[model samples]
Target: MKTIQLFFLILIIVSCSSNKKISVNTSKQSLKNQQLIIDTDINTENIIVEEISANTEIRLKKDSITTVNSYITAPVFDSILKPKHDSFNKLLSMFVSKEGFVHYKDLKKRQLDLQKYIFYLGENLPTQNWTKSDILAFWINTYNALTIDLILRHYPVKSIKDIKNPWQQRHWKLGDKWYNLDEIEHQILRKMDEPRLHFAIVCASISCPKLLNEAYTAENLEQQLTNATQDFLSDSTKNSISKDKVELSKIFNWFNADFTKNGSLIDFLNLYSPIEISKTASKSFKDYNWDLNE
Candidate 1:
């Protein structure tokens, strides 16, 4: 009876061992098949590299395009425009002190710093009085400031014309519209009836009217602009008449259409000239000098 019981125990152990072996072999075969399936027809290396290349190329193109745009439309102001709380007072003081002359050399050196001050002016502009005169004054100041900034950026150019349109490839956000430099000069500034603006908006060239030492204020704006225009037009260095044609700054020729709105270029010049001159416009505008204002 003991021998029979031992034999039955050994038989049960052997059966369990056999079952374990079968189970292990089946699992190993399943694993091998799964691995084979995973390895088959999968070019993971190529797929991964292709995806990486595509992403890299797309990013590279996007950055390259924006870089080109930035060069064309360099930020006019390093920061947004803001208002100076004491802007009016400061401007008045400059005039009163007879120190309102903006020397081109000094301005060129402080170009970046002045941009910060302009940002302050922009921040405060929205809260200020929006009267027509005030609005006009702001526009005039902005135009002059930006124009000077442009000239300074390209200080060694021979003429303002040598400076390509900064807005040629990009748009600038102005008061209510996206203005290119062309539109700013021809559409806005030129439209204003205040002709004195012709002088106040200096182009950073010798022929252009002199830059004001201080900004214009509502209190003394009209007189300031008027004086600027008369001064520019009367200055023999900038505008003089000859027998056959008018020797005028290149700006007149560039935006001749603006002057033609109220009258022809000849007519506009005639209005300011003490001498009654012929209406024949000069066939040629003088070349501009873009050397450093200094």
Candidate 2:
């Protein structure tokens, strides 16, 4: 009985030793796995932060580029248009009345003269010596002249849209290239970053800004633009305003980005608006009139 009892005690001691070794090994492995998981999580977090920072830097760089480019004047051009200017002014005075109403009927009578004027414009495109203002003025005059020509060609129509795809049809030639109305406005004018152009370029509609009686001259470009803005905003029929709310022309909504480049639309409006509007004032768009401006 003593020998059997000693053997069983030895067996129990060996079994307890084995169990303690297993417990220690399991604890060490669990700690190693937890540490590895923590390391992986930290790496993932660092990668995300780096990506976000890189993206932000890219955005800032692009914005800086845009800001710099906006200040740069358009390339100098070597074109002259003294004769074309006279022609443009003559056409403007003949067709565009003092009240800004176009006499399409009377203009149709001088269709040959109008065609000659347009032809003159295509031939005498501005050159590299022209200033930004000069180039801008030339294009605006060309666009207006072309618009009037298009209207006369399709006379007896109610609206500019009466001709299908009026803006998309490449019917006018400028220099060596053919262009559509949309091209002149979006590709050329809007690219210049002149938001007041929205008021200067009339669309031959009642809701559009009135066609100025005089041609847009480079010498008077700044004053003309300022006058256009003030005139358009002051006309309550186009932009009605109050202390708490303001209803602006659809032009403001269509080209909101252009007007709001330096500030909000309200900020732009306040510059020319007669009624003062608060920053947080309620805003809405007026229904655009597409009927002929005649």
Candidate 3:
């Protein structure tokens, strides 16, 4: 009976696949009107910004092929596809400052655009062929973007923590899964095993690592992660690092295990600290300020 069920499952999948005919018509004219984000490192061809109708199949050209029916159609199953972060990058380049502080007032003025891009993320997730780097980059962006949107929703506030359940509020649906910041951080991201990610996904706080102004692409993920880690360690305001003594942000203390996966916490700090850290250096964690990063 088990063998018969397995045979039927395979037969059903093959039959469903054989019945579907997919045809993609790229409108080069419409695509030409879509401005590529100037600073993004993603392939220009990866983004398709046409105003597609719900009846049309949305086929985006990224690392893999993804077919989506529409907002009304059931989301694609069994895969998490890479998202097009060009529009979100453009917005980030505009509203985020050199120091990583957000111009929340000005960003709030364009909340609709932000919401639209987020909805696109919901409709088109990363698929099987997307590199892990690409997928990780997508979620990092999603977490940051949603955090910003959350701040915008309750703008004019003092801190993100002031808003009720800032991290726990379920704001958007990505495919079939509804995600809050907590789930994305602990469940999806931390499990990826890249400790550098601790510095990339900000919580909209003053002490959090400055959100990268541009999107993370598969081509630039390694360097971006390295840059984020290095910048976070070297920032005097966040981590006061020296060869003999180190006073780090509370992030180091809270997520110590993450940074120590490969070796001791000092070993990880030495990788990015400008000066080599002594294993026996005095260590302390700074108070975390929850003030809004803006």
Candidate 4:
């Protein structure tokens, strides 16, 4: 009887010990699992966002994006849809002559409309659902429109360079962030690996590629970029080309690397230039005209 009682006591103690060990090990494993997840901070303050100031009169089109500037931070509006360029196109067609010179005087007179559109851009930032073309068109339009807005704000300025630090000044904000032209052009657009952007994005200068009379859209972006590049290279004043010798715009000198990515600069020019340049063509750069395109 005594031996049987002792055996039962030993079994109970061993079973309790096994259960305690398993519980402790499981607790440690759960603690280790919890530690696996790491939390980090995203620094959006340093990211880029550009547009005009918030005082524009906004009349959001039905079923379009909301206007959220300084006045309206988290505005509630209809579901945001794909961006439409109709209004901007109308504005461009009205103010931009066929030759690409803008009537800044008339445009300034209707500054509210331009300002409204610019703020609309600030509010309707790109989304992941947007295609690559969508994003490209957005920035190109944004850059050009912002340049115009800058000029209109300081109307009667003879040159884009007249504005102190035209490309670097942060004039407006999107949400809590403010970005400049440098950020949009160099950081965003140029980094997209499209060299033709040099021709599509006008600098509000005569020597820069002529501004298109219509806004760039995603569906026709490819063709528009090609057309812009071709037109720029074909203009004798901008890029004088012969079979063996080429005198290019200083734009070529400044952004030569962009054109040379696939091959030599001549190789890029050939793709757009009407004339086939010789492999060993002598090259020179013309003086850039920085006078306002107005």
TM-scores for the candidates = 0.52, 0.71, 0.74, 0.73
Supply candidate 3's per-residue lDDT for 292: 92
Q: Each model's C-alpha lDDT?
A: 0.58, 0.80, 0.82, 0.82
Runs of candidate 2 with Cα error greater than 4 angstroms are: 1-84
Q: Candidate 3 — number of clashing residue pairs?
A: 6
Query: Which tens-of-lDDT digit does each residue in 164-235 have in candidate 2?
Result: 988888777755689888998999999988898888888889999999888998889999999999999989
Model 4: how far residue 118 lies from native, Å? 0.9
**Which ranges in model 1 have alpha carbons more than 4 Å from their true place?**
1-113, 126-129, 149-183, 191-196, 242-245, 279-284
Q: What is candidate 3's lDDT per residue for 1-294, written digit by digit as tens?
A: 999999999999987776552211234544544534432425432332232332233343332344443432234322324456899999999999878999999999999999999999887777666678987998898898899999999999999889998889998988777889999999989998999998899988999999888887777999999999999988999998888899999998999999888999999888888999999999998999999998
Best by TM-score: 3
Descending-TM-score candidate ranking: 3, 4, 2, 1
How far in Å is the alpha carbon of 218 misplaced in model 1? Answer: 2.7
Q: Which segments of model 4 are wrong by more than 4 Å?
A: 1-81
Candidate achieving higher TM-score, 2 or 3: 3
Candidates 2 and 4, the one with greater TM-score: 4
